[model samples]
Target chain A: MDINRLERVSDFQWKILPQGKMQVPAIIFASENLIKEMDDKVYEQVTNVAMLPGIVNASYAMPDAHWGYGFPIGGVAAFDPQQGGVISAGGVGFDISCGVRTLHTGLKPEQVIEVQDELANMLYYKIPAGVGSTGLINLNNHEMNEMLTGGARWAVEQGYGLFKDLERIEEQGCIEGAEPDQVSDHAKKRQKHEMGTLGSGNHYLEVQRVVEIFDHEIAQTFGIKLNDIKVSIHCGSRGLGHQIGTEFLKKMLVNAKEYGINLPDRELACAPIHSNLGKNYLGAMRAAINCALANREIVTHLTREAFEQIFPGIELKLLYDVSHNICKPEQHLINGVSQELYVHRKGATRAYGPGHPSLPQDFQNSGQPVLIGGTMDTASYILAGTRESMQLAYGSACHGAGRCMSRRQATRQWQGNKLIQELAHQGIQIRSPSPRGVAEEAPGAYKDVSTVVEAADQAGLARMVAKLEPMICIKG
Target chain B: MPQPRWEHFEHQADIGIRGYGTDPATAFEQAALALTGIVTGLELVKDSEMTEITCEETELELLFVDWLNALIYQMAIKKMLFSRFKINISNGILTALAWGENVDITRHQPAVEIKGATYTELGVFQTENEWVAQCVVDV
Candidate 1:
């Protein structure tokens, strides 16, 4: 597929002109090299998104953008309700708030190398993962209701995490206006025994070491010194989130005719934002967000307990928790006035700049920490959000190195066992219950994350602080 | 002759099901049947509660996804299960009605959790005399 037709905005920015049926242009933030590597069809999908109702600015594709259900996985777009904006289930993805959270460990990698295997096993066993995996924390309706409203704050109150951890979370760990009733009974059933468990497919609990520090001051402020060991958790609201997304998408599709919305793609199926369908979807989606926050917080507690057993008095401080799939209400300076806009970020992360009132007091001087996850063998980076992000892409940035090939293609190209051995030879310990799962997520499946993160930084979207390499990976 | 079992496709940590039949109608029916098989065992759902469900899709492939996804939704949100479905596909138009019973979760168990139908590999193609569509669902 020829991908060179894109017009370059800068070294790391590109745009595609409006084509047939396109209501607006499509914007892509990637280096020339990254753009060349992208599938040419991405241009078509981006343009298709431009035609959706309530779409704002330019439909955006991050450096890691790839063809997904409707919008590209790393796509970001906002719709104006006053101007007939619509909400889509395809836009937010099945895993609502499927996100990444990073925790800072007081101990360095060198201090824990001897017990790496034990630690990895403990994490693997402690965190229930893989398909059909059941979790330890089972909650009734009343408890689940509290979790939906309280998020990580409720977990902290239950002694699951430090009170300070709540401040570092997105939406302060609780999204407002979450109506538990909006969530279906099946969604609740799915969440019953799934809380505190890490669901499968690209989800992982990794022990990493800070190998590089680009911004020394910011890294120091985050307590991320060179060689310091850290833990990263990547997962989300599990079955409950999936149920809510599915239920809403069907409702939206059925109601699309009423809104007079003709979709460019059925997957981008939507209803007008001001309509009843849109309001109900937002409420249900927010509830899933709360469920995700509470779920991740519980996982953090398990990690903390595991660490305490190993180091006795060591503390696991949270760096930040950010959801990748979501639609949120935010105040952005548009036309020099702070306007309340609804931002739909699918497989993207929100990177609020320093001094953004949403940040915790401690990070007021340093922007929100953007956790960019990489493959088990690659290095993940800690980035700080930039003011330019708010102006360019609704304070959003690439979530990770999006997939370059489908998992089936990857499985055909590489052997899971051999890949594990190769990584082990390279000094990265990997553990997972399913070997097919490992093969399906081979590094070759994804684009080069370093290149993606570099483009975001060079584009002035975010600034890099520290780089983390895996010491031991507990893959789901 | 025995019809071939549906072909399953995996797309980046998600699952997709594909099947081709002698015609579009049969393909649509098979797709629905296969999707129901994936989410839970269809044998347990009695045909006694056969209810009329009519839906229209612009294309057969999308209609198949819409039909199965709708059934899955009914099963999940409403605790209903289906044993049979009457589907029709004509000139890119699809209409289907399913039959199922109210499920008692305490009595029957679930086999898998299907997240939603994804646009991944979602397309309709013609194979000589038959119409074929492929879709990847986030399971």
Candidate 2:
């Protein structure tokens, strides 16, 4: 992240030219000040990703880049399987397919403000969260495989939601080639009781209201009217995903050398795309993605049920659901030739531009809606993917305001109870099982989300559509 | 016998868990203590029940991760928080017992749920008189 080492391409775009073992340059979409604030490890990790075989263009970092295990958080990389490309487990992180899903409730902020406290309490009690939190739906062996293979479709089949909701979800609810047999019994066992539950650490459900509109046309297309109430759930495949990552990372670590991979960091454990290990990982990872899709669908159902109980005659429609942490096969034009590439986006959200074939027909004109969730105390945003961004950062953008300080530092600086009182004074109702978790995730512990978005917009990673302010947040 | 001790080290994201003792078994026990502390203070957990655990791995470092993950699995499946841990490593197999209670939400104000131990910064080795078990955990 050192400015001297990077050549500024524009005000927001910077390039670290290839050096040492790097096979390609590394690009960062951020302002100089933000780059300075970034941990130096970001530079090291991003460059290391460039060294991976068959990487295309560069290992790019979104505006919110920060140091992570193998690839920096917000890192984006694409690899060509035909060119001996590889798949990395660390690049996907432990929380497989961790993403955000926004639900639009046909109600205004004024309608919910009067009963904010009641709603918050109700959601807190209804939603299973924190460590050892179990959900109402328990999955036996048959249901486990079904959920893994069927994804959101499975949830809908179980009467969790309506069929119309599937269109807005990624992969139309399930990705094919999810070999459940590739997923271990240990992983399946851990997920048996975790379906429909929100795991702890940065996962939350926020009740937000559209506060400002940046692009009226796009905002309308995304079903946003000024002051309209919305609920966003941020989570992923819980225990099952974690167990898969754990099992695969260990396997890849022990076999990296066998694949002729000269690991700059052992945490970047990987195998060649054609290798049996890589195929197995893809099968399991795809299943995990389906698991996350199903988990979010069930949680959305729970949210709808809670809303119906509190305020009848309400409709909650899906706005968009996109994963920030995942690796999926994609087609991108490289050197004026369209080629199949495996795109890995860890801590980065995919922002499909307008007219992209992958986008749903409703969003083809306005582009995909990239939902960004900030801390409970700050404003999040809804951004539209642009054609420029698809080419700029591989159709990816920052997921959230990346953490600026360590959790330990945040806990030491602020008391949780006091932080809650302060947020309450600002009119953001907070409900969490652990006050200590609140302190660790204090808004001040993160970079300014507004600044992060501005950098993304200026760099053409994604275009801003609207801003949202939190009214109620259920944290676990 | 040396007293078991555990402390935290700062990672950019997540947290580093470290345990020190005069022997490997004590270090493993203390490392488990640090893992529990990440969720909530170990002092808050009562020694109400004991759970037995056993795991095997060829590598010592892997064995360390296996041990912690086993405890994590037990914590999730049983809905308990453990404070006191006893570990014995013999014949490349680790057998342990953890004592605690079903979590009292009012008492154990856990900050974050530990997902699993990671290979990042993983270490298990003896240095002179002190033995250390250390690794970064994903939360």
Clashes of each: 1, 0
Chain A only: TM-score of every candidate?
0.97, 0.99
**Native-vs-model 2 lDDT?**
0.90
Cα deviation of A125, candidate 2, in Å: 2.0
Off by over 4 Å in 1: A1-3, B1-3, B8-16, B23-63, B66-114, B119-128, B131-133
lDDT of 1 by residue, A356-396 (tens): 99988878888889999998888888899888888999889
Going through the candidates in order, the fraction of native interface contacts each one reproduces equals 0.25, 0.59
Model 1: reference contacts kept, as a fraction: 0.25
Model 1 is docked with a DockQ of 0.21
For residue A444, model 1's alpha carbon misses the true position, in angstroms, by 1.5
Decoy 2 TM-score against native: 0.98
What is candidate 2's lDDT per residue for B78-134, written digit by digit as tens?
Answer: 878999988889978999999999977777877888788887788999987799999
| DockQ values of all predictions | 0.21, 0.69
TM-score of each predicted structure versus truth: 0.88, 0.98
Every model's TM-score on chain B: 0.75, 0.96
